[model samples]
Target: MILERQNFMNINQISAELEKEFTNKSIEQEDIEKLQALARLYQLYQAGANEIGTKLENLDAEFQVNYDHNPIHHMEERMKSVQSLLNKLVKKGYALSVENVRAHIFDIAGIRVVTNYIDDVYLIEKMLLNQSDVTLMQRKDYIAQPKTSGYRSLHIVVSVPVFQSTGSKPVNVEIQIRTVGMDMWASLEHKLRYKTDIEAELVDHYGADLHDYATELSGIEIKMQALYQKLNQYKN
Candidate 1:
């Protein structure tokens, strides 16, 4: 699958643009400070996400050596852009403050883990969360209870300590674990959902179709998992 990387503005560029935005709107000094603080917080978020990704890769390496199979297929990490963060804050009618950003936005540092099989998703989740240093803040098992749109993935919010110049600070990171099939469906669904110049009716139609497709793919994943288990049993 061809995954497109998200484009984000440089931190300095974002800060400059935000200053202009505040100047145009005549926002207060406190609000400006809030925006600046949020930008700086993102640096810490990026570091935390990178730390988690590295840990996962190390776990995969151990599994490959001991079990001869790696559960994780590929991992993708992203830090939320300044414009995206601002848009979310405005949409929720929340003030642009560092405190509000930490309170409301759980996915500022997002990571996606694509696995080879359905069971591998859960296995990796269990193993990762069982680590001594990793703290699992929240978990949403969409595979067991799928969304209305038929989206299926295990979402986990974890707080990992990031040793910064100041000191050790626990930073929150959102991890999304899914099978390859689920990832493929979600990737296409996201593109279709965000396509411009498309009629509203057509978009709705496509969304419904994607939901049905997701359901079918989920069924296939279950059968594949069963077959894999049987094969392992036979091998044993």
Candidate 2:
């Protein structure tokens, strides 16, 4: 899939929109500058995500020719809007500044990698991390140790260098690797979690059901992996 950079609003446009939204709150000029800078930082992050996605695609293509199978099924990329970013900062009690954003938010720019099998997820991850250009900052293996909600994915935080006219700076990008089953569960759970006008009790019930479903899905994935391994052994 081709990766495209998204257009961001300019400082004036962002300032006007924020002023309209926060009618009572005074948005100072300094704050506007900081927001503008934050927007630019997001652009850098977007570039980093695009580069990473491209590398993953290239690796998949190479594997297809040599191994007769592609590890990566698809890739998805997104960047948070200015309003959403501000809301999250406020909720986290963070000051509206570039430093605060860089320090607190590791997922402003995010990429998701969906693979055919559980092994494929780790294969692609190892390939990406082996690259000299990608600097591994952190990693979380949710597939091995799932959350209470049974969320399963390999989360990786890496820094990629973005070359600017002024200089080169490293930007952080969050990469999530998951199997097809895991992706399906996560997608549905996210939708239900964000549904409005739903009763609190109903939301809790749904959460419980989703957790149980996720556990079943994980078990199915393990069985599928074992079956695939057995088939490979027979072929060999």
Candidate 3:
């Protein structure tokens, strides 16, 4: 029987511990970041794994297999998260630990599909393997690539391993996908986003720009989605 990582965490324990963690003296910003990181990762792990599981168990036409770079024992890993993050911290130790913050410490990433057709999702997700200081943690094909207005699809969750005192375990990540049209909108929105939210005057000034790009991207997504559907039919 396959041991599920998501299976072990008891909601009751998590809730009780969270309450306990909060109640004990002070809570720092970095501590909150750690909590949020864990929550996001756990959520993605379950959702993404379930998605892969469905494709594996329910559907036989397409193939889905574990993309294990190195075997992570489900039970052992769970123990690490629980013992190291949840249980080990005390009033002073947790506070001291938070002081050591580093970039590349945490990452959320996704895989995208970037082709004209549905078969592209499969072929690219399957064949485009790469080498270097890289690990293909997970693959999700929407395009299978970045989109135009920048509306994209497909989400991948990966554990990017980092060498820390935390040992050799890879940190989890999430990735998103978009088509060319969607990506264009998204990229512009990202460029524009920095300006609007900062200054109300800028929001008034650039609000139109954001709306224009969003509408354009939404439209692009619609047209491209139809193309994807048509492509799917052709494949069938």
Winning candidate number (TM-score): 1
**Worst 10 contiguous positions by lDDT, candidate 2:** 1-10
lDDT per residue as tens, model 2, 1-236? 33334565565665566556557778777766765686577667777777787788899999989877878877888777678888889999998788898888888888888998999999998899899989998899999999998899999999888788889888889999999999999998888888566888988899899999999998898999899888877664
lDDT of each: 0.84, 0.83, 0.42
User: Model 2: what TM-score?
Assistant: 0.87
Supply every candidate's count of residue pairs whose N, Cα or C atoms clash at under 3 angstroms. 0, 0, 38
lDDT string, candidate 1, 1-236, tens digits: 22223354456765776676576577777866766776678877887888888888888888889877889988888888677888998998998878888888888988899998998998889888888878999999999999988899999999999998899988899999999999999888888888566888998898999999999999998999898878877653
Model 3's lDDT to the true fold?
A: 0.42
Candidate 1 regions exceeding 4 Å error are: 1-11, 26-33, 233-236
Candidate number achieving the greatest lDDT relative to the actual structure: 1
What tens-digit string does per-residue lDDT give for candidate 3 at 1-236? 13233353554454345446577567777666655555544444344434333322222222223321111111101222433444344422443232221122222222232333333334333332231323466554443343333334555544444443445444444434334554455556666766345776775566566656666655665677587567756542
Residue 26 of model 3: what lDDT? 76
**Cα-based TM-score, every candidate:** 0.88, 0.87, 0.34
Question: In order, what is each prediction's RMSD in angstroms?
Answer: 2.9, 2.6, 14.9
Alpha-carbon runs more than 4 Å astray in model 3: 1-156, 160-168, 195-199, 228-236
